[model samples]
Target: MSTADGPSDKNIGCAIYLHIPFCVSKCHYCDFASYAGKSHLLEPYLNALLTEIGSASVQENTRRIGSVYMGGGTPSTISPETAEKIMSAVAKKFNPSASSEKTIEANPESVTPERLAGYIKAGFNRLSIGVQSFNDRNLKSLGRAHDSQRALEAFDMARKAGFKNISVDLIYGIPGQTLSEFAEDISKAVSLAPEHISAYQLTVEEETPLWDMVEKGTVIMPEDTLLLEMFEKTVTSLSKAGYRHYEVSNFAKPGMECKHNLSYWLGEEFLGFGNGAHSFINSSRFANPDEPEDYIYEVDTAGRAGAEILGDEKDRVLEFLLMRLRLVGKKLTFKELDEKFFPFGRHDKHGPRPLFDETYRHPLDWISKNGLAEVNSDGFTLTHKGLLFLDDILLEFEKV
Candidate 1:
């Protein structure tokens, strides 16, 4: 075990996230805190990460760990030995139980049989491979290094190296991708029978090359109608293939959901390490510096980065609702919400409190009336139609 504590009501084991910020190449649409062409800084980054871990280790004695996830620009870009050292440090610092689900994210081109074996030997039990797309043209357009064939080979290599729990990532809505092409990608991914699958829509972020192309009319996005069709197709296809549509964009085999991600949605405590990694614990949410060099300097000088405490009740309530509502099957019960946020029942004298404030109440009522959601003593959940408009629904919360 990595830590000394046991799971409890208030502390149900924390999750640990390690951010590996190095990538072989940058994807045009990626906005995550990762750097390309920073190979030379790998050793220095790892050393700083180790220092942070050592400083945080004492807290682990009181916190049992439930999961460990290493995400990156691409964790596979680093050496297996480097990966192993990281796992060793985590194991020493956190003392997680034997059953803790340890996962490492890899891109198709960066994974090898030897790397997979090293991950397993280092105590990682789960692997998340980023395939992005199965179409070579789409891959090139997305700036992904691997072609469809390489993606298949990487999945095969992970399986051969004894990874029983695997997740495959796919993206849709590329400018040139047709509905039929996206369907074929889904079918091929299902055929792999991975324990989990994540299908994400392509969004153009402001600082990315995709955004510039879209702004300049050099690349046109798929019509909203077409994107909706693709989403519906994905849900229908994955369901028929025996994968549960667990979250909005995630599908998984029974009992095979990604626990680490679930923890985040469920508001569990987690500690994040490395540049730009975020943590939500002790009623505060904060992040490490986004720049690699800034992170190193901060940790070296102050032992930890500055964190923000989410102390406002209204802000907390909104954040909670936003995250929890993403889990389609898990609605927030009225009793739970009342006790945590409202405390007392709605009152006419004060013209309703923060939750029952007109700002939120009106939108929620409109949602229920429009058949976009259901509200009752049990709580609130999105209707199937509501899922399609989740982004708009979330906007309602933001107004409060």
Candidate 2:
């Protein structure tokens, strides 16, 4: 079994993210770039993914990759053999470090003991299962195909299949979900003792079926106060259970934080594969076509498509601040800022402008005064209180 050291230096190694955009059924609240009932396109899509990976290997001149994340509509929806083919192509094309985190996202319904073992044989060292909720009523409300029992069994199967590193995904604030239900979900997840856990507050996107239900008064979302209580409960319960609150919505046991995601938060470069996937490299972002057919056509005709360069320095600065602040305990430092945004040490007569300059001072002042964050000579870090209002705090920074 391969072992990875903690997060690698961003400058030394990059990561790869592959998208598997097929699902067994569409969840009511999902608006991601995934499709349901598209099983017919599976083989064609797999072939296209391999072709694209080969093409990328030729163009992406880089050092060893630190991580490989297989995310999706539900990556486990594909057969293990097909999934293994994609992993094989990746192994052939890119040099992944022995310590690299190779993770695949799975839904409980699609996960089986045989499939779990196959994934391990295919070289995936980590499993991130989307348990969502452990309550049957809550699962049904969210349109999850699996019941609470199936989710428990999925964890058992994964463990029996010899997966040592696992992560459980949970969601709070679902329609008609009570604080007690959310607490129970947290308790059960902690009992599983996965290496990592991510608890996200559900956000209803506009075009999803859940939104229509909301509009028609068929589903009522929990009030903000209730959501806040649930969020607090998550932090308290998880912390007491010995999970470190690493990111705003993520917790981990010791050195088990998701490296692929940590690379993103730290502004490290990553290459994305599959339909509707996005990549960030050298201050530019690239997106593939959302439609599988269009993505296949583009990959077949050209190497890739959709390149957007974030040429504005301010935009880069703001993005850096936003991503860095998502980290809970880490402080964003001046050296990190200078290296990324001012590699050549670009500055006026004052040597280098202070990162907390006049433009950022207003928000910084407000944040510091409110005890939401700590600003020092080197850099800043948000307190736990600040993380709760992260969106609002970031908005203040954005406005300036």
Candidate 3:
């Protein structure tokens, strides 16, 4: 896919994220702030969400919204009217650009013709369908509600419903999964010809069923080498299929990148609404209460949900570096870094360094010397081999 440039930073447009915390069933490895068997809370939750949206102090005149993403446990499970109401509230609050990209996340089993039509009518131009795996056994093992066939059908249905910009999400490294099986999954997804693809490794979070199973020896994760092999295969296969590996875990066909997610990775300001939603604006970062009841009660009683500020200069710099490195696999330029994090001239004759660079310089130097990254006029960029150990590299930065 063609890797076209995204919107210029000078536009100053922000993004909006609306969280839908409902799902038909929770996956074994899932740890997001979503709940199952909470269908009854849908009405009250939507009401609370609408109230929060309406009450948000967004400066629409100054910061025009470029994108709005409706993500959740399964946003498609909600009725069309509810979806419409949510979009209506957004329309009432924000002034989206003429070509604003609006996306909604849905699970295969929860998607339907009616839901697709409703989403389009509500101004959603992109759909992210979670099809974790195309293998029946893997789907069953993951406790996902949809099977391989159902996932394909859902994709077809979305296409028929006029969703041209579609993204499919796939997971790799499931317990007992073989390399060939993963390759086949990638092949199937390529055949479907989605505009975008996101392939993530399965992480066994603590307190989750998958973690319990691993502790009990009932589930065995793939070895590190095997996982790396899978990652390599994903990159190779997707690249061959005309998808650009734009981000570490995401691929897109030409100008089809997920703009909303790019906003986050690029460190742009955005407003998030609903339970457990986070917002970064005016140099302040905060999150609403994670629990639905807490969120509802707070919004109802206080006329606004409370938020906890993240922290000061050091914290913001750390966050900005962490998020930006994941894109273009590169470090920030001295001028860029200085302007955003330390405007008071932290650079010397050699180059610019952050406040905490004293402790981190050695490790970063090692990374550069070891060829894990390259530093030059542009900035530091991870080598192809370095992408595999991205977490380890980021940990070194975190220690500083």
Candidate 4:
């Protein structure tokens, strides 16, 4: 609703997230706001998206646009020409810094040498390929259109296209995935030596196809112990391969952490465009319509979508803490918490009271005693074991 301003906004820039919600086919486990049979509406959606960017430009704030991320329903599904058009619109409106991290998410089957070249020419510097697994069976079970060979080829094509900053995404704990298979997948990803890798556990969301299969007993997920083993294997393998466990599920070569995503985890401002996209600015949040037709109509009639204020300052503090805790080696500094939030110390008139204060020292001490976390005079960081029980750790903070 309002522009972001504060001590924290000094030199920090806002990240831009553009959502492409059309997919060739839906994944079995995906519940995102993506449509499989919406190809015909792509043109209209793109036009409306351009208009939205133009509208935001008129009301531009002081925050410099530091990064632009094109995420999907398979952003690679679009033609390179169309992708270039979107980038052109962005460049015209925002004029992002030349050094900004521009990333586009692509699927293996949708990737081609020509498309990859087009992206590089359009000023994109980073490519994130969705290679969920290197096994064909795992691919089929997850409803991926590309197999192992295609994924491998996609990487080679990206490299040949002059993309130096590449990221590979993977999923573990599939219904039939074994720890050994996951290890092999990690091994393969390491061999490629992409700048970044994101390996997430399979979460069977409610009402998804995967959830139904689980409900019907048609597919049985691996046991919790096995999933933990898989997670351990991911961390150990990635670490040994010279990747830093920068976040819970993200690994990166030194100094190669994803800038756009890191901005989010650091509780910085971001503006999202296109249907089903979201924005957070000045302690308020906003969302565009999920449906293409609805979003187009709204942009045509209102120039912008509706805004929803998430909560008061307390909620933001909790959210910030929760998000910052996801950073593996990053500390939850009390100085930052105090500066951005409780400016008047713990006794601030406007207070949620910082979670790391003396009041919660008991639970913090217990966490330290169990070796799940390390709490110090400065702040706390989750031990590797603590990451495994992150939810449980968060519950301790929520209890206060």
Candidate 5:
């Protein structure tokens, strides 16, 4: 999991993403493409996915797909037979390596010893178990179907099934979760010694049950200040416990950063399948409708969804800023970036040389002045202080 150099001289090939849209139950704060009562649609949904994969093959020669990420709605909620069927379709459509970092997002309860075995047999080498919160009370509040113990058991099962690459998902900043409890959770988690941890601060989406509760005065979402405090605590605690804050919300044991996510940060191209799945190829991203019936029907009947390309260069520039700010110590080449991306006065810099652009204002000056980021012969990178303030700095990329 140490950084694999992804094409030093040039970038080519694409990533394949499959979204599994079935969850045993919905989380209170989730609005992802999923439904608890839609079990009846799995067969047709999967057929649609297969059709999409088949269609994707003819788009380009579809060479050397670097990774395969099966995200959820609890990808493991369905049987491993489902995983195999998807992989079988993928293999027919692309040249995915046996060693090509195959990953599946799993909820603890969905991962039994038998299912783990099936996953291994189906060619999944990596597993990211969603253990959202270590506190059982918070788990209930969040509507996680699996409890704390179940998450541990799932980890054991994943190990027994011969997965060397493993990651766990954790959530922080619950309505009443204390910092001490959060620390304890990390302490307990580090004892298990997973290679990766994606510790996310909860964000209540507008249409979620949690949002409705907040509207009814039944639930209280954290304030931005509180969320910032929680993120700070997480960085400190995880660092002390021997985890590196590789990305803004992701921590990892040395050499275990998630390569799939890294692709997103680096702005690489990828294709996706399944209901409500989205894709980015040659600088474009489009997602399918959330309705399973509609998505399935479209894919099965038409084999492709119409896509939206980022119309202007500004979108790509803004996207780059948003993505790179997530990494702790990585720099972009400004001169090269300007030559390739900016290429004009679209940025409306005050004067003289091309000092900046509208899409990326080059917070290099401000961040460096505040000791948050520094520029070298390359471009810039976040300092430790800057990493703590990364979100605020990233927001600066937006209009003032």
Candidate 6:
């Protein structure tokens, strides 16, 4: 960790995520809160974010943040000077510690040597670069701003800038993406030798341009069988390359797991800050309005939400299980299960609902019997099959 300060038991349990909402250009498939051409809003947005974080800081009983993740539209899209300002305010609240996992998400297009060095000076220790593909045609099809060469150079520059723990993000199952091209992308990523690799399947969200393309006559969506075949190839290729499939979409070298992301996966609470950032604390989950102007105004002055503590306990428990099951390798013990794992509902008479009992027995038995999960003295975990059908099984939780 940087020598900025130290973390304590009180504050270290929470992870802080600061959303940077400006990208040079938005990828066609992206649904994140990022502006493609809005360079003008950067400074004011930063000021608003700082003011909001300051307000939350005063109210925070949680002492030190365990990790600080600078994710988003494109964190590195800002000039190095702007990066310093954001990092400075973040330090005032979280205080980057020796043990803190300080991560910043950088797009390949923004990873200049100076940018990388500036991020380090700003106290970011982990770098997640968006290197979504190594194939030219596929890269173009995805509307990525960087070419294969730029991505390679960006990765090289980050390593040259002394980023010891780096992660590269790759996407598979793009329209017209072949199994061979996908494997080649994984092979190239392995050759880079990053500390971690996050291989995500391309799922077209309803409002995304890629989805619209599928709706129109513009693009061909990969079939289910082909996607499954691609998924298997990805698992095989990455495994042979020494990357462990630690989570459904993430792979890492041993001991290089993303602590901030893992916290989310394991159902821990975090205070998500910034425009469009989502937070889960005290059994409720919600977000600041996704509009940059609205988010900044509300969070800076009133603090996140117009105070929306929306979503109930059952919704909370189901959401938690959905995220946790993404971690195919780890298991949460029963000791950690009780009140936190399975949230209960009030009946019509204001008593515990029948599903509360179902949480303890039915769901676990059903999944285990179906070869979707297994449990020991430790609590349940997704089996290999479970990970692939994770979303499907999570739907079951929503029902219970």
Top candidate by TM-score = 3
The collision pairs in model 6 are 10-63, 11-63, 11-64, 12-64
Q: Candidate 4 residues 1-400, lDDT tens each?
A: 0011101223447899989998889999998878899998888888888888877845454568878999978999888888888888888888898889999999999889999999888879999999999999999999988999999999999999999999999999999988899999999999999999999999999979999999999999899999999999999899899888888999888777788887788788899999889888876788887888899889889887645856776577667767777878666766776677667665766554543456567768878998988888887777888888887877776665
Each candidate's TM vs. the true structure? 0.92, 0.93, 0.93, 0.92, 0.89, 0.90
Q: Where does candidate 5 stray beyond 4 Å?
A: 1-13, 57-61, 223-226, 343-363, 376-378, 388-391
**Whole-model lDDT, model 1:** 0.83
Q: Write the per-residue lDDT of candidate 5 for residues 175-210, one digit (tens) a residue.
A: 888777777777777778888888888877899999
- Identify the superior model by TM-score, candidate 1 or candidate 6: 1
Structure candidate 2, residue pairs in collision: none
lDDT (C-alpha, whole model) for all candidates: 0.83, 0.84, 0.84, 0.85, 0.77, 0.78
Residue by residue across 184-285, what tens digits does model 6's lDDT show? Answer: 898899999999999889988889889899899799888889888878887888878877777788877776778888778767678777778887766566
How many backbone overlaps does candidate 1 show? Answer: 6
lDDT tens readout by residue for model 3, 1-400: 1223322344435889999999999999998889999888888889899988888774632577978999987889888778889988888788686578899999999988988998898888999999989999999999998899999999999999999999999999999999999999999999999999999999999989999999999999999999999999999999999988877889888878788888887799989998989888888888999888899999889777858685876678678866776665445565676567656565755486554334357656877887877766545667777777777787767666
lDDT, residue 366, model 6: 73
Worst 10 residues of 6 by lDDT: 1-10
Query: Which candidate, 1 or 5, has the higher TM-score?
Result: 1
Query: lDDT of model 2 at residue 292?
Result: 88
Query: How accurate locally is residue 128 in candidate 4, as Cα lDDT from 0 to 100?
Result: 98
**Which is the better candidate, 2 or 5, if ranked by lDDT?**
2
Error of 3 at 176 (Å): 0.5
**Full-model lDDT, candidate 6:** 0.78
**Which of candidates 2 and 6 is the stronger one according to lDDT?**
2
Which segments of model 6 are wrong by more than 4 Å? 1-12, 57-61, 299-306, 333-335, 341-357, 375-378
TM-score of candidate 2 against the unseen true structure = 0.93
